[model samples]
Target: MDPSILSGMRGFGVATIPRWPWFVFLAGGMGCLACSSLSHLLACHSKDFNLFFWRLDYAGISLMIVCSFFAPIYYAFFCNPYSRLFYLASISLLGVLAIIALLAPSLSTPRFRPLRATLFLSMGFSGVIPAAHAVILYWGQPHIFVALGYELAMAILYATGAGFYVSRIPERWKPGAFDIAGQSHQIFHVFVVLGALAHSVATLVILDFRLRLPTCAD
Candidate 1:
């Protein structure tokens, strides 16, 4: 469904909404999926392939996390460019640093799985500052709160997924029982997908709110 059409149906003003932020989120999502797909496909070919593709996968994950900040921050700060730039720049820097750390061969080892998980969680949590700011700015709007509820769900889902990824949940309990199926990594991936889906919903809700919410400049 086209967001513009949805907005029109919902009585959005006739002025064109800037869609570049939305597109940034979409591109990030597609890039993450594409990289993960390719990494899984090629990682088993050889040790070198495994190392390279896994690093790509990690970088892709970081990119997606960074991009997740764009639409929300862009729309939330639509009338406030300085704060917008600061938040975006901060997340971008963290994402780059995460990619570098995860790409390190030493850090890619099994022993560092917990560290990687912590890093990803930290990246997600970094949004807390900007999110609080947005709430302070838009707390009177019901839809903003509603959208934030969805984002909260997203955070929980992602956190649960990370927990599974790090603690090696069910498989950890039974080991070989889940060697081929119902594994921790597999479950982690599913949770991540669900989390992203929830995040997408939240992003759309925020976008819609921005289109409708009264501006302070008025």
Candidate 2:
């Protein structure tokens, strides 16, 4: 058992688990939202601004996907330092690669919308690896199972959002009716926000389970 894990355990009135993982996740979420808002707000300013802000928004999405791994991976592998480090490092590297791939201006074009969404969806779905591992690691724990359920929901929500993004639904059906409002892009953002909330609930559930454990040895 790691001494740090034991140290993080505390009695009432004190935090019972380390908070940095949650903070990392939250910061990533906020950064993504900010970039998204800026892209939507200023992309209309000019062609140059459009390209720049949209690219930043894509990069922010990658960052959030990477950071989303921290809380669950850290808590589930609390006493397994090597596994924790390996999973975290793997996701971080993948995120960097994703950002590098998206940096190509060619990928930002309308013709590549599906490609962009596919790249992001691939990054998001990669969570399945660590998620499956976590389930295997804590197979007997009901709370872990509950957390996994929420994670599954998050995955569905994100996939649905990506579908909306790539297919350009309702808006496509109505054409000019959705020009000013209710665009597919806007709907995609809403699903993303919902997905993030679902992920937050999963992380909190995992954190609570970890706190209740008397010791990492358990």
Each candidate structure's count of clashing pairs: 0, 0
**Candidate 2 residues 1-218, lDDT tens each?**
36665555454312546889999999999999999888989999999998888898899899899999999899988878889999999899989998987877888888999888888888888888888888898889999899989999999999899899999998879889999888889888889999999999999999888877665553
TM-score of each: 0.91, 0.91
Note the Cα lDDT for every prediction shown.
Answer: 0.87, 0.87
Give the range where candidate 1 is weakest over 10 consecutive residues by summed lDDT: 8-17
> Which residue pairs clash within candidate 1?
none
Which ranges in model 1 have alpha carbons more than 4 Å from their true place? 1-16, 214-218
Candidates in order: C-alpha RMSD to true structure: 2.7, 4.0
Model 1 residue 92 lDDT score: 96
Model 1, CA-based lDDT: 0.87
lDDT of 1 by residue, 1-218 (tens): 58666566554442445789888988998898899999989999999999899889888988889999999999888888899999999999999999999999888788889899999999999998998999998778887798789889999999999999998989889979998889998898898899889989988988878777554464
